[model samples]
Target: MTAIITTTSSATDTATLEPGAEAPANAGEAAAAASEAGAGAPALTGEHTDLLETLARHRFFLRFTTKDLTDEQAAARTTVSELTLGGLVKHVALTERRWMDFVVRGGEAFANGFSEREAEFRLVEGETLAGVLARYEEVARRTEEIVAGIPDLGAGHPLPEAPWFEPGASWSARRVLLHLIAETSQHAGHADIIRESLDGARTMG
Candidate 1:
């Protein structure tokens, strides 16, 4: 189930990033800028003008938080729980793979060890923080490739077998992408709070 996030800010024009900074020239720059901005800044690029701006924004958030941390730091718990910045990265990667493979491709089976759909938020023992981040990066790259290869965002794909998903129902590629963006963005918020609570690191620009 999707969690409801209530904000006083306007949803249509909410600032996901700081003003005065130039839009990133590439994914690396975008990812770095997102880390500096923390969760307070816009997740999307101000100069972004694409059919997949929403998807890009969501990707920005995921990459930003997962960028530039030492394996130990990424895995370190700021609180009493098992959630870590790295763990969140893994979770997003797992979700991306599942959505793309199951919902988008209508695949009945998935590759082993990439993720466990039933255990969202639960980090398994012996899963190194670095390993999780690396896997997340790989999965994200694959997802990007898949999205780019699609000729039409309006093209339909089968739905997963869930109560929320209708049997034999299909979704436009656009909807699937948007759902990913929204899902990642929300989790990024959770990561932001967890990071801050751990070390008092404020959100970046």
Candidate 2:
């Protein structure tokens, strides 16, 4: 369990304590403390700013693919994958939120968002396109907060043990941000094809 925990109460009072126990490791925590600073300040320059911009632009393109879509159209699956535009939007938004939460709270963030795999990619009944878009906006705002506030791009925790991931692999905050951008861009492409199939709509003007 490679977790970087610190007291939320104070910055100068930083320490990596064992889970459920309180003990300060002054020397080891020095790097960790510096790594977590600027959580409340603006993110300017460096990789964080670049990643934020890239993701924002890609997300804009993704949203554009679904413009002028009706609830029926958004929910209609145009591909054999059984993926709807609305569902893709939901997935990207949830993924961004989850990755950003990881930046703040590490592996624990996964439990906060989607619990079931099917629910993530499925558009349930009574789910309005407007409502999902609104939720997506909320997630985008939080994603921006994460990219702007978290101090260290290099800071990371070991990935949860899983066969899907390399054993003992870890993802730096930077890598996580890049992954978000990649996923968003990829889904945006999917949305484009789905939109084109739905009513000959295209993201490219």
Candidate 3:
């Protein structure tokens, strides 16, 4: 799929870098910003709150690693791997959007194409760190809205045929949410290493 770019430069945008602030100073602040960044969505409790909060915390860590970075630095590969900080942010956002579509629309969502999978990991001409960050924030907000408003987490669809997935299996919205959490967390670690190598900054101690 061609990467979509929908960016908003507002300071109040969720998980986005503020106008003057580079990024959240620490994980706590990042988490707090993520929580407070939401609009007046109805209050959630129990499993919904727990899952969203945990996911938000991890998302904060991932985005926090990109503090004070230039577009050149964000796109540069620090290690032998092809992964770059900007690329991870973009990739994760795209993946999350795809999965969310699946959560609502089922396996048909994948039929469009993943032709841009490789490009998703690199910054193309005109793609900037701030632009990608803004796009990610948009995707994140949409995710929060979708999950929060959905009536049931148990609603599910059959898995698309893939070697990585079990045959004849299905996944509920809850399972998809958990998978997104795991995927984002894993990529956040990758981004942390990339960030630390690029500079001396660490997302956590």
Candidate 2 — which residues are off by over 4 angstroms? 1-43, 112-114
How much lDDT does each candidate structure score? 0.55, 0.67, 0.75
lDDT of 3 at 10: 27
* Per-residue lDDT of candidate 1, residues 1-205 (tens digit): 0001111112311233222232234343443343343355333222222434445455555445544466666777787777778778778877877767754546453335334655556456677666775676566655655665666667765655556667887777677667787888788777766666655553332
Off by over 4 Å in 1: 1-53, 66-73, 76-82, 107-115, 118-120, 166-168
Better of 1 and 2 by TM-score: 2
Highest lDDT against the true fold, candidate: 3
TM-score for candidate 1, residues paired by index:
0.63
Query: Over the stretch 101-130, how does candidate 3's per-residue lDDT look in tens digits?
Result: 999899997787687797999899999999
Clashing pairs in 1: 16-41, 16-42, 17-41, 17-42, 36-204, 36-205, 37-204, 37-205, 38-203, 38-204
Alpha-carbon TM-score of each model against the true structure:
0.63, 0.75, 0.84
Candidate 3 residues lying further than 4 Å off, grouped into runs, are 1-29, 33-40
Best-first order by TM-score: 3, 2, 1
